[model samples]
Target chain A: MNLKELYQEIILEHGKNPRNLRKTEDFNKDAKGNNPLCGDNVHVYLKLNGQKIVEDISFEGSGCAISMASASIMTDLIKGKNEHEAKEIVEDFLGMIKENPELMSENLDEDEKTKLMSLSGVKQYPMRVKCATLSWHTLISAFDENKEEVKTEN
Target chain B: MNINQIKKEFPIFDEKIQNNDLVYLDSANSSQKPKVVVDRINEFYTKQFSNVGRSVHYLAVAATNLYENTRTSVQKYINAKDKNEIVFTKGATEALNLVANTLGQSYLQEGDEVLITELEHHSNYVPWHFLRKSKNIKINFAEINEEGEITLEEIEKKITPKTRLISITHLSNVTGAILPVKEITQLAHSKGIIVVVDGCQGAPHLKLDMQELDCDFYAISCHKMYGPTGLGVLYGKKKWLEELPPYQGGGGMINEVKKDRISYGELPNKYEAGTMATAQVIAFDQSIKFLESIGIENVMKHEADLVEYGQELLQKNNSVKLIGNPKNKGGVLSFVIEGVHPHDIATILDEDGVAIRAGHHCCQILHDKLNIPASARASVGIYNTKEDLDQLNESINNCKKIFNL
Candidate 1:
């Protein structure tokens, strides 16, 4: 119920100047996602090595503080993880954001888990859950080489 | 009219939204219902519910008469020439689709152009776009000026020899631009072009006179007019309604149904196919009565004053930018904060129990032209006051403060 829970300091900071907020040149994987309700859109780009380890990840989009910060933190932490570990972390994050009290992925370190937990505030606002999860869904789409644009409503 | 007394007629203000008074500024999207309108729906369902125009039984006759009474009320309210000119539709979107579909079937031809404005909502553009795919008609857009107003000159410029129709909004939902519809209609008529006015925003705020405007077809959204959802009125010219083909083929709209051949019914019945929104159509009479209680002149004045006050408040705030500067505007006040997104603005404002719409307001072309993804909007209705605008300004200040702007 508190506005403070939704718009924390770290969110405002990262939303103001998001990390890796650019197009990754020579990117092997990319996908677009948008929340048609509010015109929020994210284009997530990833460069994966031969072993399917993520070497770099970046995003380009405009949205609310929750979305920008969520995308910022996601691209920051997803840089070094392989495809399987990253997908597990995404599943863990989605689970934590839905009903789980804590993130359950061992692939994430204590510090990485702490950063992702800040987005748990979106769970209280059901309408805002899409803003937080848009890029993560787009990341999955990118890995699968799905050409369809990610829609939160779908 | 006393605003506080008039506000009390709506029971929603009595309820608390998150322990705060509901400051509703989303009337452009849909207005809150008055108690009489709500009670009328309850009364109809409880006592007078029946399928209209079919059975000769007591309840059916009474229900049909009540349904017909709303049609008369709408005819008088909008000052239409004939009551049959007003066809009940599901919503303004459906009304528009009916016009486009029926007109496409009968009047328009392949390669004919239908001129519209960039200020149109998706409802106005998308339906016509369907014709483009099917009939191969080209859709031309009358560009908005720097102030966002669609001038008569601009419409005149867009009308080529092949232009057969011109569909425009009476008022832009986002920019608050009131198009020069009457003049444009006159010009289009002279050029042998049909004019359809998307009057969704116009019917509730502006004066509705089909005789005066003289547009061929005008769409009205009842829910935006403080009436129930699932009901709208399509005010078409008698000639157009008669000449155009039926939008949908179903029970009541048919004059005769044989195995091989069939004939459609006359005027309004031809359009009112299938079982209609009986309860909503009946209850919308109360909405008309409610609006009549407070005159349209009074409604316009009060809303204009609120928009002016809100505009000044937002303009004075640092880093807050108003979207359009139309000289003649509506109650809509859309703006963007330098560092804050509209969704962020809406969420922060809601914390103070101030409700507003954030998005393109369903005008993506305008937003794409404005080069912003979305903007926050605060639109006023009859229940809204200067105090509500003050609250909106204060909430914007709080949102800015939170964003460290």
Candidate 2:
């Protein structure tokens, strides 16, 4: 209910001054995603060194604090992980948003779960779920190297 | 005028939103349906659901009678000279597009010009925009004044010998500025130019007498006037409707299909291509009756009072910037507050169980003209009360304070 606390200093800092907020020109994989309903756009870049992702992600976009912060944290979480682990993390994050807390708690610890709980607040506002998960969905779309186009309407 | 009595007619007013009474100020987007309209629709499906004008059965005859009864009701509602002149369309958007595609193709040529105002909605603007592009015709916009009012002088400047048609909104969706349609139509007619009036907003609030205004065509949406969605009325002059070709080619629109050639149906049916929304059309009669019972003049007066009250309340707050002219405005009040986006304002208002519209309002051209990305609008309807306006003002003030504007 406290939107100010929900968009805390950490979230605001990540939103205003996000880390890894750059387009990778020489990257092997990239995908552009947009929440057309709210005019949010994210360009995700992935650097895959064989099966192991040397640097899985970064993104540049304009959106609300939740979307930007979620993108920022998601990039940090999957940076040095393998493609399978990254996919699992993505699925787990999506399950959390879709309100499968058990699935979310299975993957993340208590402190990390509290941080992800900020996104759970978006469930109260059904209209804003897309704003919170736009970048995460974009990251999921980027996992497929051969499939260039991925558009989901949730 | 009797708030409690009028409130009883609408079932949604009785429903609570977030433990509070719903103050629906988004009527300009879509008005809430009255029980009469709802009951009529329910009755149609429950008793007499059948395809109209197709069979010799009793149900078909009854359905056909009800469907044509709506056309007559629309004719009387708008004061059209002939009932047959009115054609049922999906909505005003489709109605406007039908004119642009059918009449624009027949009348407009490569060097011809179409004069439109800057305040037109996307439905009114884009159809002509597409026509201009496809036919290589010129599309010119008349300038809007500082108060967002389009003047006769500005329209006169835009019109030329090459101007084949002049189209404009009867009342601006954003500004609520009532254009002088009579003068505009007379001027267009003087120049041998046809006129098309987008009456989607105007038809809902005002008594439209097509004989008096004498425009070549006028388009209206039923949903905006408390009627069901997917049913609209397009009132065209008989000569113009006859001259313009049918917009879409389909089954019911044709009278005879030969091996190599086909003959189209008569006036109204020629334009009506596919299976119409029969229940909605029947329900449209009840909406028209509902408006007729209360009377449009009284409704307009009530709405004007609300608009004036809203203007006074909104202007008292320094942070809130009213968008349109204060004087001679319709029921719509579009505004923007400092330091808060219209989208954020809408979200906060929604939390308080107050619904208002935010965005371009399907008038991207007007937004671009005003040099604003978006605006928030609260439009009045028959069901709305002064308390609703007060709640809206209070919520907007709350939004300003919350955003520290």
Candidate 3:
């Protein structure tokens, strides 16, 4: 309900200069996601090493401040985690965005949790919930190696 | 005309939205209904509700009279030659689909071309696309000029020898460029091609005269004309409507329901199959009365002033780029701000209760041609005023500040 809370300083900064906003050099898995409502789109690239660790995570897309900031912080926090731990973080973030009060993932540190929680303001704006979760859903599709494109209609 | 007094007739402005005053400017999507129209819908449902054109009972006859009255009013308002030429549909989408579906069934042959424009909404284009798949009809698009207008020259150039029909939008929903429908129709008729117009945006703003324009079919969205939803009117020439096959086959649209052979009913009913939106059709009569009270010329002038004022304000603002600098424009004001997405702009504006639509505005083809993902649009109606545009510009400044632009 509050615009100030929705467009926080950190979100504005991260949205302006999104981190890891590039395609992975040797991406093994990639998936495209589109928010057909606003025409926002994202393509997530994943580079998993031999030990099932996410050696690199990057994304390329154009969207609103909330969506760009969500993807930037997601890539920054999920870069070093293994595939299993990364999937857990994605579930935790998705649940928190929907109804959960806070993220409940042991894999994420306090700082990482706080960074992701800034996007929770979108929960109040139900029409915008898809913007915050499009990239995360695309990341999951990339992990599963799903060939179909991810489409968010919420 | 006193725009403020006209705004008071709409009851939604009396209430606050999210604790902020409602500055509705999304009329291109759907307009706010006046109190008279809403009250008529309630009165019809509460007291005189009955299925029309079915029974000879008291309420049935009265309800049927009311529904037919709307057809008469619409026929007179649009200057159609006959009352039977006006057929109601679910929406303009369905109306246009009816034209395409029937024409594809009876008229268009394989490899025949139907020319459309880049400024068309999906409703206008997608129907012809069906003909492409089913009947192998070719669809050609007339490109827009730099001002975002589908000029008569473009239409003339796009027409080939095999072009059987040319369907286009009366006004671009995203660019607000009002096409020269009359001239285009004349040019197409000269070449023996039929013309269909998607007037969803135009019906609410421009002066409509079916005889003057002389197009084959014109589709109108009643909700955008300050009427109820689930209602649209397709104004077709009597010759075409009689020649084309029935779109839907069901109750009321039939003459004799036999096992082997079934004959369709008369002109209007032939297109309207099954139980129609009777309540909406009745309430739409009041909508035409509301517009008549104000006069279309006055309404046109007032909205023209608002668009001019809003355009000048947005043009002066830094970092704001207005789309489509067409000399002849309608009530739409589509623009984009650099370093900010349209969804972000719309959200920030909604905080101030400045209602505007953000997205491709259902014109993705136009967006792709313009080379942008999406743009924000603030369209005006009879109820909006200069003060609302002022509030909109102020909200844009606030959004810019929030983004530290």
Candidate 4:
């Protein structure tokens, strides 16, 4: 409902020039997600080391500002964390976008929480909550090695 | 009738949409129902609600007559050769599926080709795709020119000796390109190809004449024509409708059933099985009358003028790129901002109570051909005005400001 809150300065900047928007070299896991309603799509790639620590995370897709910026900021914060930390952050972000007021994961620092909170404006726009969560869900699919494509219909 | 006066007939305009006057520009998605059509539904339910074509009760007989009257009205409206040619289905999707399924059962052979264009909606293409999977029929696409039009020549070039049917849209919902349906139908008929039209976008905006266009089958969405939902009209040549197998089998569509064999009812009833959308079908007669009262020619002119004005306004605005520039266009105005995604633009515009569509508009093939994920579209109806387009432009500016464009 509030345009200023929805399209914040940081969101706009990240959407225009998305970060880590490329296929990670030697990625071990990847998954594709699509919003069939709007035709927005995302392909999440992850490169995890032998120790199961995240070495690289990136995405390749086109979408609305909320989606692109969410994916860009997600990859930026999730690159160095281990698999457990990355999954916890994903759950916390999805929770906040769904209903919770704030992030609830101990794995994420205050700066990381603040960066993710900018996308909380999507909660008011129920049709767009899928836009903010598609990449996160796809990243989870990548981690689990689920080959089925994720479809965000709700 | 004046556009302002026409707008008053739709009661939704009187109510504030989020504290702003509703600038509804999504008619291509579905049109707003007039007071007459809405009140007809209420009146039918309140006073004369009865299941049609059933018992010998007074209301059932009256309701049956009323239902058949609407069928006659549709026949006259589309200028079909026989009233039996017009069959009511659940929706345009169901109508098109009925054609594809019946033809696949009786007429189409394995390895035969069904030609469709890039401008077809998923409803037009997906049903034929079922034939591809089950019957192994080949589906060919007629390419679109740079102007986003599916020309008659494109149809000609795609036709082979194996081509058995050609299905296409009467108007592109995304590009606003009005396909040359009449000429294409003529060409397809010359080559003995069946032409089925997805008239969801065309029925509401263009003047329809089945006898003149001479297409073998045309599917119309009633909701898009200011009628109620859950009802659609399919106009097929009587011979084809009689010859093709029945789509759905139920109580109404049956002539008789035995352990050994079953007989189906006649033309229209065979297509319409079970209980129909009784209230919606009865109410749709008023929608046809509403169009007749205003006259389709005037409606066409008003929408054409609005699209022209909207096109010029957006073309003058910086960073706004209108989608297609076909010589013959409809009421659609699709565009993309250089630095803004269509979803962002649509959300920002919705805040100003400018309701437009932002998506593939069910034409993913056309969007893929255009090489963009999605685009925003603002389509007009009989009630839309130049001031509505002006409000749309102002909202687009607000979106640009929010995106820092």
Give each prediction's DockQ, rounded to 2 decimals: 0.89, 0.18, 0.88, 0.88
Off by over 4 Å in 3: none
Judging by DockQ, tell me the better candidate of 1 and 3: 1
- Flag regions of model 4 displaced more than 4 Å: none
Compute the lDDT of residue B82 as modeled in candidate 3.
99
lDDT by residue for model 4 (A40-132), tens: 999999999998999999999999999999999999999999999999899988888898999999988899888889998888899888999
lDDT, model 3: 0.95
Error of 3 at B16 (Å): 0.6
True contacts kept of each: 0.86, 0.00, 0.90, 0.93
Where is model 2 chain B poorest over a 10-residue stretch in terms of lDDT? B396-405
Better of 1 and 4 by lDDT: 1
User: What does chain B score (TM) in every candidate?
Assistant: 0.99, 0.98, 0.99, 0.99
Between candidates 1 and 3, the lDDT winner = 3
Q: Which candidate, 2 or 4, has the higher lDDT?
A: 4
Looking at candidate 2 chain A, the ten consecutive residues that score lowest on lDDT are: A145-154
List runs of model 1 lying over 4 Å from the truth: none
Q: In model 4, state the lDDT of residue B178.
A: 97
Q: lDDT per residue, candidate 2, B200-287, as tens digits?
A: 9999998799999999999999999999999888899999888888899997899999999999999899999889989999999999
TM-score of each: 0.99, 0.86, 0.99, 0.99
lDDT of 3 by residue, B77-164 (tens): 9999999999999999999999999999999999999999999899998899998999999999999999999899999999999999
